[model samples]
Target chain A: MIVGDLSRRELADRLAGEGLALQFGPFNLRIRSNLGSFASLAHQLYEPYPLPEPAAISDFHVDISAPRGLRRWLRRQACFGIDGQLPFAPYTIEHAFPALEWGINWCVATRAHHLLLLHSAAVERNGRAIVFPASPGDGKSTLCTALIHSGWRLLSDEFGIVRPEDGMLLPIPRLIPLKNQSIEVIRKFRPEAIIGPSFLETRKGTVAHVRPPVESIRRAQEPARPRWLVFPRWVAGAPFTLEAMPKSQAFLSVATNAFNYEVLDEIAFRLVTEMVRSCDAYSLVYSDLDDAVNALDKLSQASDG
Target chain B: MLVSPLADRLIWQEWDDIYIVYQPAAAATHVFNETTVLILKCLQQGPLSMEVLRHQTEAALGVSQDELAANDFEFATTRLEELGLVEFVDDPSTAQ
Candidate 1:
């Protein structure tokens, strides 16, 4: 029937069994999968917009009818609709939802406002927000999980959605995905934390999502002005260290990590420039999550003071 | 013929006092100052005739008539074009 009538789980099942039918913003996507590598396809379809472009338009639908043998063995399969023909065999909705999410984000971003998506997690404390931006495997998620458990509000784990107009971060703190060791690290750190199902042997080793704290989810609509930009690197045995970064260097580092910085062109530049200017930038390297959290707490206190 | 070859195929975006131009395929981003930012913004909506661009820039910046036509405006526009910050769209009817 109509999308409004079906629940997310029901829609997901329909897409997995018969085929998925849902509208993401302006684009209506329908996917059919056999439940094998369909999850992979869903991820691709829903992956965040790589570059800010108009919402993708796909009218001609594809029929991906896969044989049992192919379905059971396939790790991932994807083929676009060409001319009027469905390029390949059946694909499932599990793989398509993630792709739609990403595509919808891209479409909304490009049309409504330029978003500078950063590879960072943000949290709020006492009316001020702190952003932890670091490369993958830097223990950012681990630190973020610890802070949230300690009463800091989680803003996001994978993305830092910054509005180009005011440099305010839009808080859509969803599940914080933790990889391999970090998952165990967080598990040990916050015994009460509820972690999602782990997808073992996937591309990024053991991957599981840490559910956002209930408070964070409840305050998901609260946008925060960034007060600190800390680039964190997890060093196994090193003591906690915090160093101020030059604004120029911080500017370049942040721009390099920004998702839609280049796409937004001048607006992105100004927004980021203003953001970094208004916030304190630092390099935070630590081994222990407790120590890292302490140092951040001190930093935020000093900033507020 | 007066067009600086540098300004071709460039797209400029302005935010407040900052102006930035990014060449997508080239993966290059250049930042500009307030004056240049305003100049780029003047050309952003669509290509305007140089005369119209100059007047608009003057009005936006609140420059006097004499200072409006000064060498600074011409020099900045030339340098911006040289740096691949603006472009000329060929209109057959306007072509001399």
Candidate 2:
């Protein structure tokens, strides 16, 4: 049954007790939370996700709840726990949603070593993927949001999971978290974009999440051949420009941004080398969202020509 | 004296001017720029002494002898050793 099949109260009850099992691409996550706000948001935000069969084993068993101690009495705070160990300290209850989102990301980035995990935003068009490997605050999510809405399919906003055996980019179409001013920027740029509640004054300043387009979620199982490796940067007042990047530099950028490049060792090395060799790599700098998306569209079109 | 690359543990691939090396002994991957690729290629074709290695790499990369400083050669040798790619060996006759 899909997660939406559960009533809000039923979802809350299950989350407070056993957990809600949902699939994200190749991985299964069993999320347990007693926080009503988190549960309600999960119901809405994760509605597109499929509920795995009851007997399926979850790859990560995650929880976000109040710690049992003085903090719970002093000020209700939420802590993220994976398999009973808390990796992050508690934040105010209001930050529960972002905490949950980040907790899952941590689970994937830290554990998934067999696959080449890149810190990138990926989108697809015409069965080919364009990977944007960049550090946080490089405006990747904003660019990703614009592209997905402008006709491209979102593979992922935080991770570009490459299946090593086949060299295909797996789709993990989860919610894209928009931080600070980008939230308002995306909202004004695409008023139709569905944004979740904002959590103020956290570590990343004000933050909100935009739901993955329903089409992206619907096509989440489809893997795309990587055709372009573009490093995108959003510079203030800069005109849109795309420059061809040397494959050597592209290799370094990807190696540096990869989460498990070293852990995967030779497999990671060959995978990245082949990816750079296969793709038309570029470094893109742009200020206008429309221009950035157009530049990417042209790059995607280059695959045909 | 001939220097041999650590053949048992080291693996590498080249793309254009870039080469990525994987050393199973260290379970690490190292990327070499064009210049480093030239240096490594010289080392790969049987091991040569620091002097011979530097001369061959310079000839291959079009780098003049004066441009290739002693410290630069030492740095590359040390880096390759650290990556488990190359190592210095005493002359066989001298050892006997």
Best by TM-score: 2
Which residue ranges in model 2 land beyond 4 Å of their true spot?
Answer: B1-4, B7-9, B33-35, B58-75, B94-96
Regions of candidate 1 where Cα sits further than 4 Å from its true position: A1-113, B1-96
Q: Which candidate is the best by lDDT?
A: 2
Candidate 2 residue-wise lDDT, A1-305, digit = tens: 77888988989998999988888887899889989888889888888778887888899999999888787888899999999999998888999999999989999999988799999999999999999999988899999999998999999999999999988999999999999989998998899998998989988899999998889988888999999998999999998889999887898899889999888887888888889989989999988999988778877776668
**Model 1 lDDT per residue over B1-96, tens place:** 222233335555554445555655455777676766677767766667766777778877888654675587778887777766665556555677
lDDT of 1 by residue, A1-305 (tens): 23334544654476567455443322344556444444443433233211112254543233333334665456454332323354334334333323333333444334434467776889999878888878878888889989999879988776778876678887766556678888888889888987765657544567676766667765766788998989999988997789998765677678888767767776666777777778888999898888888888887788778
Compute the lDDT for candidate 2: 0.87
Inter-residue clash pairs, candidate 2 = B3-B47
Position A181, candidate 1: lDDT: 89
DockQ, all models: 0.07, 0.55
Model 1, position A161, has a per-residue lDDT of 81
